[model samples]
Target: MRFPSKKTWILLGLSIVVILISVSPLLKDGFPKNHDSELYMVWLSEFDEGIRDGQFLPRWVPNVWVGYGSPLFNFNQPLFFYLAEMFHLIGFSLVLSVKLTLILATCLAYLFMFVLSKQFFGRHAALLASSIYIMMPYHIGLMYERGAFSEYLAMAFAPLLFFVFYRLGQKISYKYFFWGSITVALLLLSHNISTLFYIPAVFLMVVLFSKKILNII
Candidate 1:
């Protein structure tokens, strides 16, 4: 196994530091006031109940819409809530779980962006690109301002999907194909709107690299 070089580790450490600083606001005593934070907390609570009641992937959260119930999960993306549920099951409070999920998404966004950037650019440039990606106003605001957890998680998958497709464009292999498919699935589950937006870009990439794809087939 080829381990990262010393400089690569340093760059990764720096990236982690940047991610930590950017998410420090989440470390506050309570959830930050945001548009959707309460809504996510409610959803997560319902999801937890569903899980305990043996509904692995709950579509109808029983407590939503004044107990009349809403098929919220059936229509909305559940990936983010699923992740928060994992944290919740592990003993964290629902609010903390939600915050942790956002923090995790921030870390994933940096790591994925770094790996994708490093594939084309050097480690230093990758560090810069990832730092910028994690610190983008909209990226930060998604968690701290809007509490758009699903969309935020989707952002983490975007670069990973691009990296996978870019590799397949160069050379098709079972490894790349498997990862590409998984990335697409994760992105689709993460956010519907983001997936719709990304489809065009992915198609463009496929078109640009059609010759290579054809040669492989």
Candidate 2:
């Protein structure tokens, strides 16, 4: 396999550094000590059972709210827990899976920011933007303190959605439209609440960016 160039390596190292500094508090020694973590484990325990019963696509988490379960799965964000469950299914422990998901989310956020920013701005600007994305105050709070895993994962897709939108605007073609639709779907699946807020931002970008919205409409 070919190795990355020195510049690639440097950017990658910067991404890792930004991610680590953002979540440094959680890495002090152990997992987060909080009610949310316990809730995650409980949800995963039931999720594992459903998977064992051949319910490959879980729509309702059967016992989450003190045994009086609602259709929480139907509305809850699936991407983060889906990843964590995949880890558990593949033999990693539940808690470790959650930690890994947070780290993976952090990495993907930086990488995606770098890609989207580089597409419009220069490499130096992209690196700076990606670093800022990593160290955003609310982002750090979510991963280190609040433990809102799925919402945190949603951050990476925000820029990617705009990037895909730019591509679709660049050419009124089938392929870009398809990919743009898929990106929107992924963002919605990751976190519906974030998607709701993203809608206006997307339209605002359409208005601001060289009037690209005209091409699509």
Candidate 3:
């Protein structure tokens, strides 16, 4: 069977440590138990039921809005609930699951920032970028106070999406295109408001980068 290499394990360990530190406030309370955090928990029932019934992707939340229901799965940012369910399946309490999802997103943001930066600058620059990212006040509020969980999930993918798009320009490959599209789609699914803001910047960057790539070539 295929397995993770030693270096992969080392990176995973280091990432876990960094992510835990980012959510250090959570360790004290075992994670926030109320506010906007609670609404996400209220939505988890459908996901839990869907998992057990083997109905893979949920389409509706049948018990929302005083039981009138909602097309939650149709419009909700899915990655948060999906990641939270994985943590739940692994036996964490629901609150902990949501918190862990945030931690996981932080880990990805750090890891991808490091990787993408290393390509442009070097290892030291990558470390600096990742450090700055986790240390930023906006990230702190998003995780600790604002409880902007879905947006956090989307943020992790946004940088990676841009990096993958840039890589596609350097080396034309179907693999790069496939992964790039998936990243863009994930960003779109992450948050409607965020996606609205992202679309214009994305199109502008594509045009600008395409021109730069052609000039360099």
Tens-digit lDDT track of model 1 for 134-161:
9999988888888888999999999999
Report lDDT (Cα) of residue 147, candidate 3.
Answer: 70
- Candidate 3, residues 58-172, lDDT tens digits: the string is 8777787898988878777787888899989999888888877877788788888887788788666777788778768887777767778888788777778778877776677
Off by over 4 Å in 2: 1-4, 26-29, 210-217
Pairing residues by index, what is the TM-score of model 2?
Answer: 0.87
- The lDDT for every candidate, in the order shown, is 0.88, 0.78, 0.77
Model 3 local distance difference test score: 0.77
Deviation in angstroms for 198 in model 1? 0.9
All candidates: CA RMSD (Å): 2.4, 2.7, 4.0
Give the 10-residue window scoring lowest on summed lDDT in candidate 1.
Answer: 207-216
Give the clashing residue pairs of candidate 3, or none: none
How close to the true structure is residue 85 of candidate 3, measured as C-alpha lDDT?
94
Error of 2 at 32 (Å): 2.1
Per-candidate clash tally: 0, 0, 0
Model 2 alpha-carbon miss at residue 156, Å: 1.6
Query: By TM-score, is 1 or 2 better?
Result: 1
